[model samples]
Target: MTRDEFMGRLRRGLVGLPTRTAAEIAADYGQHFDDGAADGRTEAEVAEALGDPDRLARELRAEAGARRWDQEQNPAAAAGAIFGLIGLGAIDILILLPIVFPVFGAVIAMLMTGVGVFIAGGFALVVGPFFGGPGGVLAAILFGIGLMGLGLFMIGLMALLTKWLIDATVWYARLHYRVLKPALEPSNNRSQD
Candidate 1:
């Protein structure tokens, strides 16, 4: 494909992205073509080296999502990042959806369970003294403290796990992109020769 055709397809593929972002991406790819030309390559060779514009757009979207999630760490950004990664491969969706959903569900359940335990502990701490004699009140206070500690620990652990999950997903997506990228480069070299 010529540079104009390649950029047109890329711009179409980047439709949902913010205008500035899409323009920046287009300019970046345009630079790639310029660089290739300086190295005595044709627009078609550069386009081929870059791979399919639609696939490139998808990968760029995934990278952008990952970057946004890293910056914001919000649910919306996380969802965008996850869906972008999943969109990269049908095989990934087929293999990962079942496992990912259950793991996330377990994390959420654990967090809720932790909160419930903490609340129960607070209730016990407050009401136990009212209901019981001296030794019983002391035992209830101890139990409440123990329960609260356990709940806090569970919450902290879950937070760490959630962070790790996001990091792993980003890593996997980047790894997938890197693995495919070199396959295109050799063709560019062969075309040059």
Candidate 2:
């Protein structure tokens, strides 16, 4: 392909990627082409020497993916690995009674958690005015009870939501890993088979 056609294709393939990354790649290839042309090569010949657009894009993608994996795999790092995320999901479900009645509990937990958060927010809003009511002592008593229930509900709601999120992410990551592991680990292909 001509340089212009290759650049257009590359740009399309890199859609949604950061502009800086695309610009750097374009600049590098442009420089190489310029250098080669100066040494008595045609644009077509230069592109041919440079290699296939699809192959180059794939190489860059693999490099970027590798860097991402390395960053994630490093222990004592803030960013968690896919496996760690999976385990977190497992723990969230186990702690929040996710195993008892997966479908029913998840739905109920979501509803209850929403109610709890709403009630807690309501407490914050009414706490000030509640102190000035005619039956201030009685108001305070009721407010205290409401606050306690709100706190418990919020805690339970967050636990339930967290469990759902983790489980979904774990399942997604596992499926993705299954598809990618073979292509990525050629040495283990025979064993996997």
Candidate 3:
């Protein structure tokens, strides 16, 4: 079947599911059908490869039902978990804005640095010979070197912080999946049994 047709069938099969859960299952089943078709399978073969829709639908319904019951029993915990996740994602994106858009960050940094260097150079060029001959030039040289070093240091520090934040977010997502997947499965098949 075409992708849309397959999705329609899957969506109908999962009619009782929560909207988010139904959409996820439909999308997953659609991808499965697409993969099968990519291997030169006919529509019937792809549908068969996805297996009996009724059985899949039942399993999904059971899982969702069990999860809902679990959430109901621990409403506060569920709310905290869900909102905690949303908050974390929001925080990560806010922090990553400048990091991922480094061009903008770099441009701003460059503009500031250019203005700083120009002002320092202009001062040094105008005042160097009066202070202590070559000693004045040395002082200006030292000051310029220090300003560039400080700028580089700030850039490097920001890069490291961004990398760490991104890595932490990835780790957090993987940890959440690992914990939640098994939690969603009924213990000892109690619900189905």
**What's the lDDT for candidate 2?**
0.58
CA lDDT for candidate 1: 0.84
List of clashing residue pairs for candidate 2? none
Over 47-144, each residue of candidate 1 has an lDDT whose tens digit, in order, gives 98788998888878888888988998877888888877776765756877798789989998998898888888888788877788567988889878
Range of the 10 consecutive residues with the lowest summed lDDT in candidate 1: 183-192
RMSD to native for every prediction? 3.5, 10.6, 14.6
Q: lDDT tens digits, residues 10-116, model 3?
A: 67767856689898888788788778778988777777556556545655664454355345534343333333333334555566556546754665566567556
Which is the better candidate, 1 or 2, if ranked by TM-score? 1
Higher-TM-score candidate among 1 and 3? Answer: 1
User: How displaced is residue 104 in candidate 1, in Å?
Assistant: 2.5
Report the C-alpha lDDT of model 2 over 8-114, residue by residue, as the tens digit. 77666555445887788888888877897799887887787666675565545434433444454332221233334333234444554545368545656766766
* TM-score for candidate 3: 0.38
TM-score against truth, every candidate = 0.74, 0.38, 0.38
Q: How many steric clashes does model 1 contain?
A: 0
C-alpha lDDT score of every prediction, in listed order: 0.84, 0.58, 0.58
